[model samples]
Target: MEQLARLEDLPTRYVADLTQKNLVPLWPSLRNVLPPLKPIPHTQAISWKFKDIKPLLIEAGELTPIEKAERRVLVLANPGHGLENMRATSVIYLGMQLLLPKEWAPAHRHTPNAVRLIVEGEKAYTTVEGEKCPMSHGDLILTPSGLWHEHGHDGDEPVIWLDVLDLPLVYYMEASYVEGGECQPVTNTGTKSRYGKGLVPTQHHIRAKNNYPMLRYPWAEAKQLLNDLAEAQSQGPIQVAYVNPETGEDCQKIIGYSAVMVRANETIQMSPCSAAQVFHVIEGQLELQIGTDTFNLEKADTACAPCFAQVDLINKSSEPCFIFIADEAPIQKKLDLYSVRERN
Candidate 1:
C-alpha cells in the first residue's frame, strides 16, 4: 500500500518541476533511449536476381540517355526497411547503373563513399579526378568521397555495374554534397595505363588528397592474385581485402571491402560477425547460408546478412566462384563495438 501510494504521488511531485521549466522525468523515456534489450534489426536475408534486372536495364538504356539522365540506375530497395528512402538494407544503398555504348556519364562528386562492382558489358572506364579507371566484368571500382569521377562506355554493348554507397551514414551525418562538372583532362603519363594503376606523386600530394589511391582494381589482377594465393594454400577460399595504395588503409573509411574466390565444390564456413555485410556474386553459383536461411545466388546476384549473422559460402558449380563482399566493420571498429564469434 505504501509503494502504491508513493508511485501514485510521483506525478504530483513532477508537476511542479514540469511547470517551472517544462522538464519531464527521464524514467518514462528510459526504455526508448536506454533499453535493456539491444535493438532487433528489421532487415532480413534478401537476394536480387539478375535475370529480372537485366531486361529492365536494357529498357532503361533504350529509353534513357546517359548524359541526360545523369545515371540510369535501378535501386535494389529492401522491402523490410527504409520504405521512404528506398535503401538496400538499413545502412547501405545498392543500385544497378547502366551506360550504353558511346554514352558518357557526366563528371560529378559527392560526400558519400561509392563502390562499384561490374555486372555486365565492359570496355567502359570510370575517370576519377583526371585519372581514367577502366571497367570490366568482375571488377571493383572505388570512388572515395569528394572525388570527381565520370563514366563512359566505348564498347559495342551496353555496360552495367552495381553501385553500392554508404548513404545512410551520409544522411545521418547530414554531409551529403553533390556537384557536376566537365570531365577533367588526363595528365598522368606513366606505364600504369592511368586506368589500371595508381600514379605516385609527392608525399605532399598524398597527404593533401586523403582519398583512396587505387581507383580501379581490375578483375584480371584480382583473379590472378587469388589463383596465385590458392596455389600456395591448396585449401579453402583465397580472399583479399581491397586497400588504398597510399596509406594501405581500407578503400572506404566506413566500409570494409573484400573479394573471395572459392574453388569448385568447396564450402567455406564463416564465423558470426558484428558488422552487417552484403555480397555480390561475380562468377559461378553460390549457396549462401545465413543462420538458418540458405540463399542460392548466381552471377550478378546479391545477398545480404545482418550484423551478428553467421554465414557459409558453398560453390555449387564445376568452376571457381568469385564474390565481392562489403561490411560495416570499419565504422563499427571506429566505435570500439566490433566482435566476432566462431560458429560450429
Candidate 2:
C-alpha cells in the first residue's frame, strides 16, 4: 500500500511538470535595422543591365513535368525566396513568368494598375481596349486598373516576361476584381497583325502616351543614350539616373506617378516636396535614408517616404542599381528647389 501511494504521488508530479511547460513567454518583435543611404546618380544607374532571363526559361524546360508546371521565377529582389507554384512575394504581386509552348493563361482583370515587360516570344498578343500589343522581347504593355486583358501565344516557343504592378496595395484596400475572356473573345478578333494602330485612335500626340504625349518610348534609343552616358563616365562608381518622362516629372498635364534610376554606389539628396513618394527598385541593391529611418533595399523591394521626411538614397553595391520612384506629381507647375518637405 505504501508503494502504491508513492506511485500515485508520481502521477501528480507528472501533472505538475506538464503545467510548468506552458509558461513560455512570447518572443519580442523583430525590428529591421536600416542602413545609411544617399541619393543615387541617375545617368550611371540606368546603364546597369538587369540579369538575362533566358537561362531560367531554358532550365525550366529541362525539369520534369511536375516541376515544369511549377513556377520557376527567380526574384529580382529577395533572390533567396523563390515562389514555386505559389503567388509571388513582392511589395506588388509581380513575377517573371515563363510560359511553355501552348500554355495559355486565361483572361483576367483587376482594379490595380498592371504592366508586363516582355522578355521573349512573338505572335502572342495582349489585347487592350480593342488594340493588341505584341508581347515581343523588350516591349512594355499596360493593363491599367479595371482593364480586361488576355494572353494568346501561337508560336512554337515559350514566352516570358517581368510582370509588375500594385496588387497587394489594392488587395489591402478590399478592392479586388477579376473577369475572364473565356466566353468573350478579345476585342481584337482575326486582325492580329495590326500592331501599328499608331495612335490607338487618339486625337493628339499629347493625348497618345497620356503622360505628356509620346509614342513608343523606343527602348533601343533609351538604351543607346544610357550606354553613351556610361561610356562618358567610363562606368564610374555612380550614374546620374533621371526621372522617367512618363512618370509625370514636372509635367503639368499628367496625373500619375514618376521615377528615375541611380547608379550603384552613387548618392543623391532629394529636393523636398509635399507629395509623398514610393521608390521601387527593379535591379541591384540600395540603402536609403529618410528622416531618421535607414532602409537597406534589395531588388523588387519598395520603400515609402512620407511627405514630411527629407529623403536621400545611396547605392551600396559596386554594380549599378535601377529604381523606379513614384509620387503624385504636381500638375499645376514644376518645382525647382532645395526642400520639398513642409511641416504641418
Q: State which candidate has the highest TM-score.
A: 1
Which tens-of-lDDT digit does each residue in 139-235 have in candidate 2?
4566666656666567888776666555545666788767655523545443332213222433443333433222223234334455567667753
| lDDT score of residue 138 within candidate 2 | 45
For model 1, the stretches where C-alpha displacement exceeds 4 angstroms are 1-38, 189-210
Error of 2 at 121 (Å): 9.2
TM-score for each candidate, following the candidate numbering: 0.85, 0.46
* Candidate 2 ranges beyond 4 A from true positions: 1-101, 117-125, 134-139, 152-176, 183-221, 224-259, 272-278, 283-285, 290-310, 316-320, 328-339, 342-344
Error of 2 at 187 (Å): 8.6
Q: Residue-pair clashes per candidate, as listed?
A: 0, 23
